[model samples]
Target: MDIRKATIHDIAEKLKITASTVSRALNDNPRISDATKKKVQKVAKQLNYQPNHIASALRSGKSRLIGVVVPTANRNFFSSVIRGIEEIANSLDYKVIISQSYDDYDKEVQTVEALLNARVDGIIASVGKTTENVDHFKKILRKGIPLVLFDRVTNELDVSQVVIDDYYGGFQATEHLINEGCRRIVHFSNSQNINIYKERKRGYEDALIKHGIPVDPNLIVFSKLQLEDGRESMQQILDSKIPFDAVFSSSDYSIMGAMQVLKEKGFKLPEDVKLVGFGDEPFTSFTEPTLTSVNQKSIPMGNFTAETFFEILNHKDQSNNIPRKTILKPELIIRDSSINKEKPKDQTNLEVIEK
Candidate 1:
């Protein structure tokens, strides 16, 4: 009636092999041949072998775990990034723990503490939208735990970050609209405190100015850039009787909402108003008039973020040599929503620009 968990030693005894050999095989060590590793693993599984992570942590002084914090996992962009991170993490025999902040600053702070309490080797995070005070992230640095930020990054903390060139993205989106004969374009943006949004807004303005179009403060609507926010902003623009022929939103969700309102108002897309959005969310392509958007390169962002974390963790002495900021180029996916001129229905639509 007694039951106990099987150990590496038990597997070794069952296979008539040394415990060290069994351990190396279990770890998929290069020294262990594939045939030996397969046999050892099969036997270990048959014996219901379970690794003692606590003992391993105690001996190695590492949990062999990584923490990832994101605003939410519902979005394709965030989930894709997490997948990319797992690809690298799994290869290194490390586990990833994901925490959701739901865009709350207090919750983000709590998650950092919780991850630290769990003794994670390092943390990879995308700053929450409402997180203006980054003291919680700074605390991780004080403890010497590697922290890498991606996507929603902050300049307040001096840490490694992976992000797309948002300024270039905004510029490209705005310039594309202008080239399509869109003047008096309305813009949907979020808080200016976040560097990404700020840079995007800057790019939008500069692009307009470069085309001899004066930047109109009245045309820029600032909000949380959610779907509801997009609806409200579009309504506001309509109510103000602002003459506009295009809309460029920083978020795909918001632009989708704006598109909904525009349709409800009996406006014909492209013919009446050209539209462009950011993030290049998958849903963009399936909409009535497929949306043109900025692709953030989520997969590469996640890979680079994890790589940066390992760099900080494994090369603490060479920290100064590591680049503080890594920027990925953004791609513009041209689609029906942003095109005013007539074209073939089967035109391919991907444009990669240099930084």
Candidate 2:
């Protein structure tokens, strides 16, 4: 009762063909005839033969594997993005290996290093919040491995990237609140060090200025934009006695935290404190009152990131040429959270803007 794994040699022996012919047929090599290919494939399937990817990669110098790095998969945005990446990679006969950084800088560096050590053909990544120095990413470029950044990216590295127009999203979110008659709108920001956060903050300020409202420095609260950070920021705003009628949070989690505080404190949403959040997390719609948020186009961003990696791989000879920076537009989804009944302005319509 011995069991054995099937190999190309087994299929060749069973079909009375040379192993080389079987190999070429299985790989769909142009040298093999269609009849031989069909016969080899059928025999291989009958024998439960699986191609040795490692050996093939070693011979061809292509692992056909792509590595992806994200902040965390627990969030809806990152998970959805990974799904989109896999869909494209699978179609191209490439495998994907995913890693998480948990928003930690050192962890991100370690993950990238591990992927490189595994001999992945390419990499798609979203930098962590604390990632300021990109020397490790430079190492990937030095090794001539195709790398593409998505979502959280930086201009310090000269590489292809896929990112949503954070500035436009912020502007739209802030302007929507302002249109709802919110004069003193507070902003809950995560970190100004990150490019996305900085762009969003700039958009918020610009929108206020455009609407003839003086940008109040006191209304801006900076933190990690976590749940506790949101609660603490809200508490500080209450303690400071700063007059604020609306809030535009940079992340959905932070906004939920702030909303919790508002609810406990008996502040009526939209009536007392109109609020808008970024990232349009799934929970936004299911909350006590639906949240108004900006859709980051996560799935499309991921798909484009994978596509860009393949484009680079295909043009490896010219990879050192000018890099491509793809910017996608975001949509603002209006809901019960940010609308004022007295000043309603087309909540049913979805608004999209590009930068």
Best by TM-score: 2
Alpha-carbon RMSD of each model: 3.7, 3.1
Worst 10 residues of 1 by lDDT: 346-355
What candidate 1 gets wrong by more than 4 Å, as runs, is 1-52, 316-323, 343-355
User: Candidate 2, 299: how far from true, in Å?
Assistant: 1.6
Query: How far is 118's C-alpha from truth in model 1 (Å)?
Result: 2.0
Q: Write the per-residue lDDT of candidate 2 for residues 103-148, one digit (tens) a residue.
A: 9999999999999888899889999999999998999999988889
Candidate 2 is scored at a TM of 0.87
Over the stretch 221-311, how does candidate 1's per-residue lDDT look in tens digits?
9998999999999999999998999999999999999999999999999899999999999999899899999999888888888887887
How many steric clashes does model 1 contain? 0
- Give the TM-score of each candidate: 0.86, 0.87
lDDT of 2 at 17: 89
In order, what lDDT does every prediction score? 0.89, 0.88
